[model samples]
Target: MENYYVFIMMCILLILLPGPDTAIAIKNTISIGKTGGLQTMLGTCCALLIHTSAAVLGLSAIIVKSAILFSIFKYVGAVYLIYLGIKTLWGLRNKEVAVTDERKDEDKYGSKSCFKQGFLTNLLNPKVAVFFLTFLPQFVNPGQDTFLPFLLMGATYTGLTALWFIFYIYLLNQISAFMKRPRTQKVFEGITGIVLIGFGMKLALEKAQH
Candidate 1:
């Protein structure tokens, strides 16, 4: 019981942390609109579902355990993160306007593309897989089957994530008009770009712990 409570608290705190996922949400919100943010959120949650299934099936364990596999997954994920960061920074460098009419992005990133964007962004990040593997086990009881507990815990975590991000999206929407200012837009993109690249480098350099 206490373990469950602790797990919930930790999950909430972790979800609140600003990371690549949060960066993606913010960037999408700033770029397109509320619809884009919602689609991104859906794609992100779907990816979490996939990660949970993979972890329950021991696929994440395989990736974590096999040094070669882990390296490949880690590097690919890292490169993707870095690519997004550089692309964002490069756009800013090239004087790309951060906030524009939705029509402009309609062709560049349609509604369907938003889903794919979020899906690929979350799917390629193996750190999320590693996180699910390492974090879920802490709450499992020793006497029971781990698989059941893992499923329930993963569901709980994912649900909490969805809940929090809904509020986050709402808050961003409330401020969208103000944040759309050109200066603020540049600052937002600049900060997100730096953070994404930093996370990429950190993920690339970090050693796996079994």
Candidate 2:
């Protein structure tokens, strides 16, 4: 029970810290509103399930043990993030003023694309897998019943992620009205792009501990 409490606290702290996941969630929220934000949140949660399952099954251990495999995943994640960032920045640079008629059309298209955008954005991110392998084991006691601990940890992480994303959706939705302006949208996209690139660089440079 005590361990569970500690695990919960740790998960909260980790979620509070800014990362690619949080940035992506916030950007999606600002760009497309609550539904889009929720979709991204669900997608991220699905990725977490995959990571947790891999960790529990000890596939994370194999990936962590093989330097080559680890590097491959790391580079793939880095490149994908960088690509997203560059694309966002490019979009910002090319943004044109929307006429009144075009604004309505954009809104229609935006609503429709929100889910797929959110889903693919998170689904393509490989760093999520690396994060699970690197971070989840810290609170785990190998001496304890390993499977139970892993299960508890996975549950804790999923809960924390859900709570955080829900809160983010609520808060961003309130501000989303103001963010509908062209300038606001461009600025948000630019910031998200820069942050994603930073995350990619950090992941690319991280060294594996033997």
Candidate 3:
């Protein structure tokens, strides 16, 4: 159907748009390697799946209606983003000093840590819940069974997301040699740090729709 085609196109465009996920993917891939990036991507996709399930079950509807609940998730998400930004910037300072193996191990996020960062970054963001609630239902025909359509669309979105991130991670890896230079890493990390903080502040200021 034409509507389905449009939906797929929209999904593709949205997937390509830059966001915290992209920033983290780029950060992890450059810092830890492709494996880290994939782990982060997996975490994010899992979060997306949960959001989809929540949306289908009408859980997101409750969050939308309650301003208090909305704020709790929003602020938590925003605070976490800001925390990540600050941690990134702090790492820059640590670069100047000699780091022991133990310190290096601590500085370098392990797989589980990276995965958790990706999961929580996505899971805590209420806007994602909002998106699924508001964005996915428009194309469904009225009076039709909604469950199958929702699941299908959600799975499509998730698959598209994974594909896009895989390509993105590969692209980042391709130029990783240049990106790994000391000067370049410092500059890239600083910019991403600021971007994350900016996103967090912006999200904090976001108003919940009635």
Candidate 4:
């Protein structure tokens, strides 16, 4: 029971830590509204499930043990994140006022796009694979059938993540009016871009454990 409590606390803290996931969520919410943010959140949750499944199935262990595989996943995820950051920053140059009604329709991202962004960002991060591979096993008892325990813990973590993001999305929506202002949106976009790139660089630097 004590271990379970500790695990829950740790999961909450980790979820609250700002990363690519949070940056995307905030960006989508401010730029596209609550529905976009919800779509993104759903995508992230689905990615978490995939990671959890991979960890349980021993696939994550294989990736973590192979240095070459780890590096390939790491660099790809890093480059994608960096690309997203650069793209966001570059888009700032094209003033929103210059967007005509037709252009606006063409330029706007749909629900699928937001969800995909969330899914790929979470899915591509090898660190998430490492996390599930390492973090979920500590709570299992010796001689226990590990499969059920691992699934339960993974589900718990996913549930907590979903709950937290829902609350976060709601809070952001409350401030949407002020945050949606042209100047505020630009400033936030700049900040989000830098944060995503920083996370990408950090992920790129991550070393595989022996």
Q: lDDT by residue for model 1 over 1-210, one digit each (tens)? A: 229989999999999988787887887777667787778788888989898999989999998888888888788878888988898788787554443554576546665766776777788777788899889988887667778788888899889988987898889999999877768878998998898899889989978768
Model 2 Cα lDDT, one tens digit per residue, 5-71: 7777878887898877777777778766787677778877876776678778987777777788778
Error of 2 at 52 (Å): 0.4
Model 4 is weakest, by summed lDDT over 10 consecutive residues, at: 101-110
Instruction: Order candidates by lDDT, high to low.
Output: 4, 3, 1, 2
lDDT of each: 0.82, 0.73, 0.86, 0.86
Whole-structure CA lDDT of model 2: 0.73
Runs in model 4 with CA error above 4 Å?
Answer: 100-108
Q: How accurate is candidate 4 locally (lDDT)?
A: 0.86
Q: Note the residue pairs that clash in candidate 4.
A: none
Whichever of 1 and 4 has more TM-score, that candidate is 4
TM value for model 1: 0.90
Shift of residue 56 alpha carbon in model 1, Å:
1.1
- Model 2, residue 33: C-alpha shift (Å): 1.3
Clashes of 3: 0
Extract clashing residue pairs from model 3: none
User: lDDT tens digits, residues 1-210, model 4?
Assistant: 128888999999999998899999998887778887899999999999998888879889999999999999999999988988898888788847555762455347556778988999999999999888788878877677777777888889989989988999999999989988989989999998888899899999989885
- Alpha-carbon RMSD of each model: 2.3, 3.0, 1.8, 1.9
Listed in order, each prediction's TM-score against the native is 0.90, 0.84, 0.94, 0.93
